[model samples]
Target: MPLPRTAGSALLALALASVAVPASASSTAAAAADVRYVALGDSYASGTGAGSYSDIACTRSRNAYPALWADANDPAAFSFAACGGAKIPDVLADQVDELDEDTTLVSLSIGGNDSGFASTMLSCQYSTQSACERALRTAGEYVVNELPGELDSLYATVRARAPHAEVVIVGYPHLYKEGGLCLGGLSSAKRTAVNQGSDLLNETIAGRAAAAGFAFADGRPAFAGHEICTSDAWISGSNVHPTAEGHESAYLPAFSAAVSGN
Candidate 1:
């Protein structure tokens, strides 16, 4: 049975706290000799807010974390398959093919779009708190009720396609500090909700990754003190996508560590 939306947040928190999977650094690093890399996900993965776009349609950026990670590591083969507006279904249909038997590494930051996080943020930013609450509630329902099965199926597909690949599932960063003073215009209540929602999203991703035996990279700590609400914010204006620096400093390192197993 699908979990109630109201219980989703609590369940997600428990799941995140219980994660025991280590970072994929060493496992992926060892495979660097013949690595066939593929990067996948949504706007965050494509580097939407970071600018210096490589593809206008996908908003892929040369400075995006995936690009930077690839440059630093020098993988034998790399394909950036993530798109700005992708959901889990899009990945199953379009991006999964990028992973084949020879694929040595696959990293992705997904599930945010499946949860309608962008729309929830927009509703919160531009509309009433009640509207924001409603949007988030709906998103939470999707996270608990639908996202898990979708991720499980996707992971299975990837495993079937690339049995030898080391898969790293990256989670989103927290947009705001919980109850901290902030420069961003969002109200404290809104910020709290967003942070909580981000947690739920990350936990959902992490739990699924753990269950699938894929490494889960928690990006929250990487983004600590560099949230959209901070003076030296690494997240952009809407508190969603990362800035180039955020990708380089936070995401790049996190991904590198995950893949290199360092």
Candidate 2:
């Protein structure tokens, strides 16, 4: 499903507005004050299909995990720097200027795109199942073997910009389980491999983020056995995005993790 255009613009406008927050306010606040958060990363971070458009720019939706986190903060405390399709390079290149010394918490979900997961899924529509399987494995390899260095650099950049903040790296949701949900379309063997590969990707991400002294919010363990194919699914919207309830499943726990430093 396509994202709402109005939502994107609103978020962008909000980002521009946040650029000018008086540093004195964010910097000198009580240590226990609601954090000045900066949400960063890809589509999942933006809460695409998770809720209503947060009134800012072509970005931040009221229902977005970032905004949800902020709204539930007793007061709206964070400023979003997240965009639906952001890449590691984008974040490192000063694209999210809202991040600065005052940012108290930073949460981002990325790397899936870097592994070409979207395009691979698209290709699977036309290619043979075997080809898709290979692509999925390749995607896992890219995330595990190559994406870490990039993630390390991105995390370093954020930590450098906001030295006082506790960073949180949110991992992607599981895309499949053995045999999948598509009723006999894919073989059990293939589904098992796909899920296993996804595990590798998430493990790699969690390990790297841990090494960087950031909390890793892994959806794998929490959402395990509850992948899209399961009853009480943790993701919805035809496998691309989470349903409203799915958002709670993914982000609510993440929010708890953020508060608890998990």
TM-score of each: 0.85, 0.77
TM-score of 2: 0.77
Deviation of model 1 at 132, angstroms = 1.6
Model 1: per-residue Cα lDDT at residue 86:
95
What TM-score number comes out for model 1? 0.85
Count steric clashes of candidate 2: 16
Candidate 2 local lDDT, 6-75, one digit each (tens): 9989988888778756555565454437567777877777776565766344344566666666666643
Model 1, residue 136: displacement in angstroms?
1.2
Candidate 1 local lDDT, 57-106, one digit each (tens)? 99999989888888877888999999999988898889888989999899
* Best by the lDDT measure: 1
lDDT at 112, model 1: 86
To one decimal, what is the Cα RMSD in angstroms of model 2 from the true structure? 15.0
Q: What is the lDDT of every predicted structure here?
A: 0.86, 0.70
CA lDDT of 259 in candidate 1? 68
